[model samples]
Target chain A: MLYTPHLTTRKIMPEMQEFPMLSLSSRITPEHLFYIRNHFPYPIIDMRTWGLQINGLVNRPLYLRYHDLLQMHQVSIPVTLECAGEKRALFVPKTRGEQWELGASSHAVWTGVRLMDILKAACILPNAMEVTFEGMDKGVRTDMQGIFTYMRSLPIKEALNPDLLIALYMNGKPLPFRHGYPARLIVPGWYGMASVKWLQRITIIDQPFKGPFQAVDYVYVNTAKPVETIRLNSTIAQPSDQQVLAKGEHLLLGTAISGDSPVLFVEVSFDNGMTWQPASWLDPHESYSWRRWCLKWTATNSGTYDISVRATDAAGNVQPEIADWNEKGYGYNAIQKIRVYVD
Target chain B: MLYTPHLTTRKIMPEMQEFPMLSLSSRITPEHLFYIRNHFPYPIIDMRTWGLQINGLVNRPLYLRYHDLLQMHQVSIPVTLECAGEKRALFVPKTRGEQWELGASSHAVWTGVRLMDILKAACILPNAMEVTFEGMDKGVRTDMQGIFTYMRSLPIKEALNPDLLIALYMNGKPLPFRHGYPARLIVPGWYGMASVKWLQRITIIDQPFKGPFQAVDYVYVNTAKPVETIRLNSTIAQPSDQQVLAKGEHLLLGTAISGDSPVLFVEVSFDNGMTWQPASWLDPHESYSWRRWCLKWTATNSGTYDISVRATDAAGNVQPEIADWNEKGYGYNAIQKIRVYVD
Candidate 1:
């Protein structure tokens, strides 16, 4: 009989768990192992009266009750979600916010109504340039100065892509409570922050949305484009980082994925960029799911060794060696390094 | 005393040697190890009479002698070059062509006059969509029905980018006879095929080129755009692929780079995608140079293991877990997979 690795969840306030890179055996990361990222504690609401409103610069404002969406045309897509700060624990000198590793990302089948259809039904006014989303998960926080509801927006064009959705189900079932029970916005290609949970209201505006989350919080320094794409990335899982092993042969395991395009190749180096060998895929890859790969290494001498991995995506983007340090340490995709001792 | 890895160059007809991934220690790969990929044998010509002519759909056809270009305003930039089939050997079912492994690529500092400057001097006529380059290395081939000179083109806009150059020197010295002696086209972000060597003429045309190199060969099936950017990629040199290592402390060595962007993170997997460990950088990275990284692995057991490496560029492009196989095997950037048995 084969043995399956168990999920690893760490104890934290808003609730978080670092997905062990080893359990990444399947394409769609099971909902149980999916990492959870929340700005505030989960808020529970009565499903009966929970409604999503769309107003502002719209010819016909929409007031959609959760039930109305269920009656509309439905669609599903395998989408991957990542927090603005996924692997922040690896950041040196430390940065503020959740110290997540690769556990901050996961893939699931999202079933919902097309966001474009909703925008069209609202009859977007001519001058509308952005569509904003407001979630029922409201709260006062140290960072978001005033009373605020978790909100975010999309450019008019991006909102029109048929792929974007106001999701009502996750992994073939009703949305999980911790994952926004009634409905949630699923911005396919962007980070998780843009996917407002517990969706409540949406607004179309001509000027850029200046709410705290949009105007300041999610950005790094003055870089306006808030950690949008999941940077070309990979994570090593087996022969656990810094683990002591007996001198012999062992297998190296890990996962790699990108948001902009498909991944092309992954190479492993044991001598500091001197020479690299390729890794084999363990599972078929989907655009949104992280790719699993492995390599066979024969360790002869008993001592400490340094190993490295680098990946390049189909769009021809190469992972950088050093990440540009940001105060909040969002989007930490720098090449990972580690040391292990041998007996 | 420390052991320094030596560069490896395989013997072949057009005179080829796989760049020892180990000796890839510097930003500009040393001259000797740069992969040698020539369509035809070197063509010798008197430098005094060598002139670059600009004609076809142009208001003014200009002819500039070699000496004139040497005296004109010039610029030097670090650019990387890669043959269309750089990693062809890695393709499955083995496609037709050189069957190159990874040595079909190299980095160099090119000194030349900006291609934009020369194009402006030609006074381009209206409706010029493409700019073509003709080289002096004329020869007859099985692919070309008759005798033909190597030529390639760029969309007018790409030709005007100041970064594109009419290179006269490589790595602070006159271009080597075997490496496009007098002058050559240096297309900074494109594959090596676009940089026609031993240049002679420049022509602007309104219609798409139907040349044998562009239409029949250098392409995947009937697609038009000949492999442009080098897909984000990396290679390991030290501890050569499939090398037997003594079970002890060792540093995994390798290099990663991208033609279109700077590399981001690189990770090493010791158990496929199930686990990964970060690798450390051994040298500072530059835009065009492959980055050097090292990771420490402690081999505690004896068995066969597959080690894999993956990289991401700053643009957020991740190395794909697989490569789309092409008939000519051009631009193959599949994640490198290697097997090593540790004793």
Candidate 2:
């Protein structure tokens, strides 16, 4: 197993861990450091017997072995996956969940065959309106009856996106045991919940999937609407909150990302939102990946300052001043506020 | 004026500001860097006409010049003053006020004559029940009908504490304009609110004083009882929240303080409160002033950690796991929890 002692473990039963935002200084997160989110304990998978099953609404029912998929055309791309509940602890009134602060998201290179490529081989029928992906992991839920597998669905239009991948490799290395050893799904531009791990079967359906994860858990409690695409967000990586520094030049660094489009630009405010200045981009704009930005701040005087950062995506979505708070605490994309003292 | 550009500004009219927690590493905070909490605009004072008035229930009402009090027995001691509303923003229900995070407190050397010494010379009448301190600054209150000066009171028994002073100097220098010029009352061991500034009068009352500041604002909203002594509290000064450090031997530092007694010991927890280890004291035990503490933390593995610190006072009061929730958010003495990442 790769060295992964750095991830912060939020739960031990289902094995949920988070990536540290300070590690965002690196363009692509190391596979071992990438966050892991699971619904149930790791399912015992025998590589020799593991197979990918594709059926329902398809002319050809295909069940291919792991070696058979490895022989298919493989594509590698960098993508960012953010948990819907990232920054859930920041919500007022206290939401229920893992209470992740701001590290429930990470970026990495995923390599695998495009799910569309597999669907084309299966010859999807015209009547397929949505496709459901189910993981082998199953457990009993207090809110539901009997045992249920971790399952989620995507609309046919989203499912057909060529960017969606049946990922087999992370950061150019075989998937680690804790991060779905055999295989996992990678739905770019969407929350991590859509990328089901411990992949087992895919079925095309004529209607939306209403499993507990898709219907009750991940949905915004106030609206009862399922969360999907990642929201525009930015977080400071330098001058950690309440840090003190000597009066001098300091680099204010942070990262920004959006699922819909590349971050167009980032702006920072030092006077509590009174004035904003453009920050220099550290990394070239890349779709489906976090963009690092920084500003050279020279402190001529000593004082405590509430530094804030906001990002605007190419699609014109700017991080809001105050996020629309929901009971489940999904999609918290408010401007990042960090307080620092310079002496 | 000593150069003080480091204080964080919370309001402008009355000039409320906070000293950064990172600057707490030093035992004695500089006069200019000390937090400034004011209710009304600074009241202009002419040193020539300024005189402390001792009247009401006193047997011999007396008006003494500043120089006259200076000639009396004078003493200097280091004391820490914390605003009752410090960490008010951490309240879950969200209280209504300045919304100070944690910088609204600091330590300074105060030099002045004891309030008990003045009360003795003035011959307080046996019927005196309380002492009312009134500041020169005045403003119209939305809750009240007419203009009102900032005022508060202390029971006669507590008012006689020899440590309480009508301070004239801070950090070995005459009080600065913003701190309170000429003279100000310093009720050691009490919240900063009771240490009335811009002192203009001291009236010994025959009954409990019911000024707005005493009976309305500083009191807990749910209980309606006034907040008095500072709560036992501790704060991490190093490895600030979300800070990323290289994996190695590092020193964890922090400061703890209490109003009732000196901090007896401090403990650090790295395993999320499961087990705690003692932290070495960096400063000699000093009552009414913060005690600095540090621990050697060697990180053998890279991982995200929720480092927590808790302090126990000599009076046998230990910091609580969770502070009692109050509407106004006063006396937040919960154990300090800070998250950091090691890579």
Instruction: State the lDDT of candidate 2 residue by residue for B1-343, as single tens digits.
Output: 1111255545544566767565565878887667788887677788889998988998888897988888988899788899998887666655555657667888888999899999999999999999999888888653456788999999999999999998989988988767777888998889999998888899998888888888877887777777999889998877556555566798898888888887889999998899999999888887688888999999877777889999988789899998768865788888888776665
Cα lDDT, all candidates: 0.75, 0.81
Candidate 2 stretches with Cα past 4 Å from truth are A1-5, B1-343
Each model's DockQ score: 0.01, 0.02
- The 10-residue segment with the lowest total lDDT in model 2 chain B: B1-10
Clashing pairs in 2: A6-B303, A302-B5, A302-B6, A303-B5, A303-B6
**What class would a CAPRI assessor give candidate 2's docking?**
incorrect
The i-RMS of candidate 2 is 19.5
Could you tell me the lDDT of residue B23 within candidate 2?
51
True contacts kept of 2: 0.00
Number of the top candidate by lDDT?
A: 2
lDDT by residue (tens digit), candidate 1, A18-124: 44455556667776556666665667688777888999999999899988999999999888888778887667655655556556787789999999999999899
